[model samples]
Target: MGQRLSGGSQLLITAFVHFQSSFIFIFQDYLEENSTSIYHDTVSIGGGSVFPQIQPQSRPRTESLDLNPESSLIVEISGAVSDKDRVLFTIHTKTTLPEFKHTECTVKRMHEEFIWLHNYLVEHDQYAGYIVPPVPPKPDFDASRAKLQRLGESEGSMPKEDLQKMKAELEAFRSLFLQTPKIWADSSEYLATFKKTVAMHEVFLQRLAAHPALRHDHNFRVFLEYEDELSVRTKTRKEKAADFFKSVSKTADEALRLTNQRDEDQFFREEKCLLTSYHAAVKDATAAADLANLQRKTMAENLLRVNLVLDNLVPKERLCTSEADLVSVLSSFFEGYQKIQVRLASDEDLKFSDTLRYYASDAGAAKDLLYRRSRALADYEAANRALDKARAKMKDIQAAEDAQFAANDRFKTISECARLELEDFKVRRIKYFQKNLVDFAELQVKHAKAHIDLVKSTLDRLRDIQPASSSSVMKEPTDSVGVPATERTVSLDDAFGSAVPFL
Candidate 1:
């Protein structure tokens, strides 16, 4: 959490981020330029590769957040300080909805926590509780004896034991006790807390959005500091590297079991043998792959930290700044692009697997394998560009090498997969040319080299062979006519010249 000073403000501002996966698009004739209205949806938001939409999975959205008057759950809040205002909000918990399941503890938890809210609503029903969710839990605490017996073994155990055992256990627990948590959580139990809180917040946000007082008032804006998951992930990566490296010393590693394909001996020269299928599927890897998954699950404090930071800063940052003050105001915008880059980098890297498999099937095809690899190749180029950018931005942000990353435990099997596909395609293509289609095969073999040379010549825009060679990343331009190389130029007249002398 490094601090940077700006303007007259000496207050500390670490990296702040906001990512709105849930957005209500607004398009209005009255507004010349498109303006953002947080909760009020002029248009329902949907997501794909570019635009991420809101309502849930792949289809029609449940309810529109239209800013028009027809929208449900309108709320109005009035009188507050700037974005940094410390105004309290009351939320009633119990409500009857047909679709909602009557969960036990949540119902009771809601009743106890919002008793004051219920009281406040009774007196000032008009606006006090408008922000409360439409479908909230009924009062009940899920502490059944059978429930405790079944669900409480791993987490709910521990005899006070002896003093040393208690101290050691507590100490061990404290080591990695609280880290990156889920996105949404109250002081409730962990089972389904994150989803519940977000559901409740959605309704509240909608209601507060429509509130006449909030909509009209300039000062009482409901500034939302959306959590960008990047920071948590970034910190997670840093922590893993630190933890793994900090305690371990440089040790001579054991010999790795790699089939040395290049090592030729007096014994034999054979083509590489590839496995038909990988045994320990990447999803079941015991080491790096598993660790990565565990990291995703155990991320705890960072999540909480981001939410609290958001809660504090959303109101504060918006007070004197406009959204246009991107880098000038919020640091999230500065760091977020890196996250986006990393995501793209990761996807491109995975896509390399696809590219390898497809090309292995048939690299000659202009459309199928070659076209698909175009994206992969572009990703490689993009990765280079992104690396340069990141390195320029941050002092020492080294990008993981594509080749090395591809060789990681998760990706090693992809090689085997590609190899099998390549063998099959080669056999099928060669067999077709040799037996079934003699004329086609002969023509293909004859023209392949010439066609490849022509294509290369056209690409290079030179008649003669040039000194400058293309990157080996692309497949070597092949023979236009056939499967084999025929680089030596031969004249039929030379062989017959001796016989022709007598004639």
Candidate 2:
């Protein structure tokens, strides 16, 4: 780290840096060039996009995962100052639910780190362009250590009480980490700013790797000086270049594969096919129900006419037998027709038709999933390749150099695992859709058959019934009950329509 300075001293440094910048036209031009380069690098490296990597397939969720701030886990701390002005806090983690998992770890506040980061951001306003996340005031470590000494733990060894206290502090830190979203719940500006800072940093790294002038710049060196770990184990330009090249190659390959996968995806088209089939089925079912209802109404009307003819017009006539039989058959057919309508109304297939339409939208989502999965796979491959190149480069270098790229290998491993998990999810999703499609087809067949049976039975009943005697049915009745003179026979063209579409 650089020399720690008071607020006034840091202001003086910023002023001086600003003045130096004003005198350098060449550096100003370089900054402009670097800004444009940043956009290109952020979007793509070696003709392949890298950032905003694809994620794995998320499980279908019926409810949101957002946590209520008031209901979330929280860490509460109460502090008291010692004679040395050291703040010691008694901390504990509390959750809304008893079932919430808990683990404790060592907790050390980032008092010094906060100061350094704050001062750096304030001084380099053009570079940071964002505020640091809120950090708690520094606690007095000296006072805390003194209290620990008084607890009878000698030679830097910790007593059980001290260890327990440390555990509580660790738990507090962990709780705080988990509660970040809640802590910054009011505004997302912080996150946007954070992204900007990261992008800025990434741009700077790429510039440093590409341009020697930037590597030697006083301001650049000062900006990098805080990264003490990097200084401890450094890689040569050649090794860095090798890693970058390997990453670019992997990213390009992954992007290509993703594009191919997207183009080859049949889910969207299949979903459309399914929707069209379902739409046609719904129409057919609706038409069947309409026809049945019409037949029932028509039969009821005919029964009324027959009743009028038998009760008053032909009460003691032989035509009574034929009229009574007609009434019986019509009533039976109407009852059966009503049942068919009822079944059609409550049909699971009809209900499932809506569900099919609902899930038809999933095909679109599935396409998106494939896209995301492809991107994620590419990211994982790129990370893995970069790590591999780093490791290979380290093999020929000192152990210190190996330490510089050790984290790369870990990151790459995690990415690779994530990609594989996403791939597994896709496979599972495919199976799920396959089963759903089969079930839908079977149900559709069953429903179509029900409609066919209803129509067939109805036609058979109509054919079996005939006017008892043509002259008896046609002759006018003179009784008080008046029957309509219009013919009661159903027209095949009007009722059944040409061929029973489905039948």
Candidate 3:
């Protein structure tokens, strides 16, 4: 009778495990399909923007999207050093191109220099059709320094282990930020700033390098290969004011065009609407990801505090043997859990949040391309009207005709370039989001498995110390479905569901 009952129980557990696995698989499929469906539905609504939707069966192309694949120019931020109030970046360049003075060279540049390069690209009339990469943000470490200061102020009441951990982090920061080691100071802030800025600058240079026309730009070549400073000056107050008003005028023009003008081309019309919605969605996702990361960091800190308390309790000589063992195990568990949480948070920030933020900015650039095209269209129409009036008046007819012809050429050129840029933007966005999302999902699964293992091991240790009841010995930890936690496995497919398509 006992044997039969045990066999029956085993069968029931096996069936339950299968059911649970099926449920998870079904849920994952639902999420993948539902997300895609929602995006398509949202994009299908009437708007000026147009984007080609990725078919369910179609795979994103994996070929090099670079227009100038043969270009041998390489640029990198090799290192950076902080002066009293300024940070200077060492831009290392290597090229086999004849345009450069040398095959390899390095030059120091500041944040303002990077801005100068971006502004030059933006204002140049010849490159107006191209989607200029967004400017890299200025590196700021104020928040990091403030956090370190707060940590220092609380040092008197903090546990020794926590204090030591913070010091170790600071040391790591110092090593990353400076060529020479310095005393422990605002390491987290500086390290974060360095990583963010380097990533942004690298993306900016890579974008410029990949462009067929921009790569050959004389100013860009000088920026990369020139050994001396570019000697770009900061904008004067008058210039700044002019720039502000120019931006305001442009915004007003965009709004007016959005209301009055409708794109005749179906492709461009969908692209404009699609890009605007996509950018807003990406921006929201980035914010949510950042908030989640912040919460995880806070949780890790709390876990550290709990671990410290347990560490202190474990050393108490008055505690019983079982109590001491339990305390020690708890401390070890929390410490490991805290470390895993920190690592998980960092992975998500780097792979998910940062990727979303970057694409958000890039999407904005794409939108700007649409805006510029629209503006060119408006100019062409205005020129046509002016020509019509001149023909009616029979005065300055030759000049009016020339103006109309010029506007027509400019509009056609911008339209063609904008189409190519938008297509490339689509391909690049998909490639990046696919890679980053898959990596993030895999990391999440790996961390989750680690968490389960930690809990299972901790429970086993605790069970061994606990006094046995008359009923039975402690059994191995099992998940909700009654499957052993140690036996549970998550495959990449199960975790990632399917390839996510981006707008």
Best candidate (score: TM-score): 3
Residue 299, candidate 1: alpha-carbon lDDT: 39
Choose 1 or 3, whichever is better by lDDT: 3
Candidate 1 residue-pair clash tally? 36
lDDT of every model, 2 decimals = 0.29, 0.37, 0.70
* Clash pairs for candidate 3: 48-269, 49-269, 49-270, 49-271, 49-272, 49-273, 50-269, 50-270, 50-271, 50-272
- Decide which is better by lDDT, 2 or 3: 3
Stretch of 10 with least lDDT, candidate 2: 59-68
lDDT value for candidate 1? 0.29
Candidate 1: tens digits of C-alpha lDDT, residues 30-93: 1224223221333434432322223212311223232233433232221111111111222222
State the lDDT of candidate 2 residue by residue for 229-342, as single tens digits. Answer: 212223469977986997687567646764454323354334334545654664565466556545654554454343333233222333424334444444454444543443
> What's the residue-level lDDT of 83 in candidate 3?
70
Off by over 4 Å in 3: 1-71, 82-84, 148-171, 174-193, 314-320, 456-503
Give the top-scoring candidate (lDDT). 3
- Prediction 1 TM-score vs. true: 0.17
What is the C-alpha lDDT profile of model 3 across 89-162, one tens digit per residue? 87776678787889888888888888999999988888878999889888776655565685779799877877
Scored by lDDT, model 2 comes in at 0.37
